[model samples]
Target: MNKSNNKLNKIIDYIRKDNGINNAIEATEQASLLLILKYFYDNSFSNTIDKLPPFSKVFLKGYKSHQSRNGTGYLTLNNIFDERIKSNSSFRSFKKLEEFLALVPFRVHSIKIVEVILHILDEIQVDESLADDYDNLIVSMTNSSISSGAFHTPIALVSALVKVSKPNKMQRIYDPAMGTGRFFVESQKLVKDDFLHFRGNDLSAFACLIGSVNLLLNGICIDNINIEDSFLYEDNKKYDLIYSGVPFGKPSDISKYGHEYHDYKNSLEGMFLKHTMDKLALEGKAVLIVPDGLLSNMTNGFKDLRYQLLTHFNLHSILSLPSGILLPYTSVKVSVLFFDNSPPDEDVWYYDLALNKNINKRTPIKEDDFSEFISLFEKREVSERSYLVNKKSILNDRLFNLSIPLPTNEETIKFDKAQEIAQLNSENLKLFSSITNYFDVTSRDIKVENTDIRTIKSLGNLKTGNNLTKSELLGNGSFPVYGGNGIIGYYDKANRDENTIIIGKVGLYCGNIHFSEEPFWLTNNAISLEIQDTSRVFAPYLAHLLRGLDLNKLSTGAVQKFVSIKKLNDIEVSLPSYEKQVELSNYFNELEQAKSSLDKLLSSFNEGISLLNKNIILEKVIN
Candidate 1:
């Protein structure tokens, strides 16, 4: 391994300390940078940092302080984070942290603090022997530009995508805002020294170092990786399999770009797309991780990017990722844009990875709670694939990309001329999806001869659950309550008995799922899906069946998250008579017992893999 890579990893270890920093993004960035400086000093590339300039020393100190404040001092200029939250109520959609985001604009809007820190590092004194420690330090710190320690698209998600949506192989891949080199790392072919091909860029020099190191560690060549602010037209590189998880929001006007683009606060993602196309080799492919707001931003900026993408690339697919992918900090819904440099294809394969559960936004891979989504998306059945009414297919009329028409019918419609004859169809999708997809079925599917749903609805006005002290703990309930991620002890008070069938009032856990009925309490975080109908509704049996169904898509919340009780009733449970409900519930009770036994067997299987230490691979990967 190169001295630089070694140095960076050491610094990252010291700063991150594994258990120390929860955010993965910081660990990668800080580790790489400190290593570079140490490598330069230790390898005799440069003498003491003090041998040169004075300002550089101050930059190092200031950067250290900033990162320590939040351990993101090196590159993230978070001065304006607190201020951005206070901009106004228009941006004040979140009730819990209204003031925090409002202040982002005021505190550290520009990267000046980071720039100064960089300047200082450029001129500071250095110690050669401490290279390893320094490298570890750099990697552990969080970054301001991108949320440090993000839940990147899982490797399984990518591999499944490759299998289902087979793209042309032998094409070069690229990540424009490659933070810690996630997408690239997953693409590297096993048993091979290099990726079939790859390239990437990042704003932070620290991030670049980490990304570069990550690439090298994966056995990919270092020369292919470029560390620079890709948005500034930095690396004149190109590729085919371009995969990126770029940051969102409007573009900034840096003096480096000159004044013509001064008022550029549009989709930074859109700008990345333009850049991706700019450097893309002939017939290159790109899969961009973008925000959902961009899909319907309606701004000319969005329209322009969408139109340009349609013309230059074959818009292959749009996979709308589940919400809460990056939660506890951010709740922005993200989508994947998969396209190729070639002309338009016959049809765009749009899939929705229906991940709607909230995740505890802690670090050290805190996302493990929802991590099961990887397997689910991978298991999503292929074929039975319809553009409209398919059950397994996440993208039916519910998703908007279905707007594009198949040209097969164009000759039949020579006189109709659909493109010019009709208007854009975004509004139609939202309206139809709201009324039909979420509702109608789940609500009206119930057919009662004697008892009405009112019996279940009258469980003495649902009481709220506990008010958690730690906001991060909000998603991590010990045992789930009525909702998707709440626990039993996390309750305020229970007006009803223990056997009450609690329902998820908000999110997808609404219609189905019952809680532990042994004198347990539900959290205010979840609406108790109670049923007063003791005569008809077999709560446990119903909960089991309903739990199988996803109810999050029908949820409705404005600022504070919530689901409608009226809409939740539409779900029709396959209640097999009162005898069957009891028999099935009894059968399920036994099944649960059997599952525990099977779970133990599965647990034993994992024991071997768990015993195999990750550090063992270090020797093979490094040299």
Candidate 2:
């Protein structure tokens, strides 16, 4: 076992050192192909030799001859490589290899590299356990680059989904967006049935190639893998089980699907959901990892989709995963939805797998972490982490929001608190205008007096904050980390100490203004303001002024709106005198103090009301 692990590590080290591979995705793909070839070559000598392609022997023979002469022999392996791949084109699983090879950069040292890798593979004994070693190799390579590894699902997540769904013998399984075939490989470990058939598809030909190789490494030869966008294409065959981690946030051009999907023409999640529903067999179950927005979004499209899910399918359970589950790639919170084609259930089970520990690349989710969840899942018992919500409540009260509902006691407290806060905020806004009336009047007077207009550059220096990865942010850190919006998470250290004005520098929240009084860490997603002349411009006052200007209009980028520091610096503002500015700042401070007092009063009021209500109930019961 140690020797096999060492060989796998050696292969990963070799690929990482190769200059030809630009990223982890490329390195992993190359390693997968080499490993698959070795697996098949070794199997060619066994009783299952007939399943191997005829060209397999020829390919290995030519590779060995070329290696013997140190890659300088006149063996002409390029033609052999092309011929072998072409010969396998008739096979569904291997046809995508041609496209995958075209994308891979086979450099001058490629043959020598392959030879070294093949020699190591030959040393390791080929067995069913070897597939796991190959999976570990892929995981190691993919972790080197986050963006490149975004498609690969973490094994722990896959195992949890598999265990929850519970694959059985003689079942047909399918994954529409099967990246590297992790779901299939994990499922195979439990079922171990010859009748268990696997089918999958992916948009990227490279992904299809790697997925095919992954399945083959595990002694599972699937013939129905395809390289096509699952959203646009329609598969007629129904499956017993479907599992997928569909793409989120990317709007698809679903015009080709016709007018029935007019509302969901741009929503990729909606399309995938509709497609999955259509493809399920009479009792087929689907386990999907979807973004949290799909559950609570008020869009007409999302509401309609959720309504269909509740009414048509037997929605089983929802597992809310942690936020940083897909860290470094994206911090979007996701949940698993389990449903089947049977009669609809009146209530749906929900398990909140809220982990206290931070989940990142270094510390990932594990199957064992879900031990309590798995034990309670079958009975659908109510506990601190799990609950049940009726379908009527979801449709009538929530407007089809499927997000896990907060506990009754907690929900009432939060709703009361939020109502109080909203009222206070509305009153505060009114008071803000009255206090800052001097500035508004001064600006109007300046227009008549023809006073000099001051640019932000003259008042302060604007610079983007430093970049910090999601992994760097801690769950229980000392300081908040501000992103494009407000504080995204907490960090261990602070980059800015004083009260500073920040503007969202990119994406959806571009040009949104925020004022941070406490020390905080700032990311490049926002631009911070350092007042050069504090006497003339108070930070809070400047933030309020910029908010009125509608700075989002200055944002650039057709797809992802962003505002550069130069654009912010060029924004013109009508500044009042220093004394007037200080007076306005003082008023703003007093308004904040008033709001703080209101919060304290509301807290006391809530406690008193709770005690009074309890006493009333107890008195009525005694009487």
State the C-alpha lDDT per candidate.
0.47, 0.71
Position 25, candidate 2: lDDT: 60
Q: Which candidate is the best by lDDT?
A: 2
Clashes of each: 76, 0
User: Distance from true position, residue 174, model 2, in Å?
Assistant: 1.5
lDDT per residue as tens, model 1, 409-465: 222323223442232243334444544533433343333343233322443234444
Candidate 2 versus the native: TM-score?
Answer: 0.63
Weakest 10 consecutive residues, lDDT, candidate 2? 614-623
- Candidate 1 overall lDDT versus native: 0.47
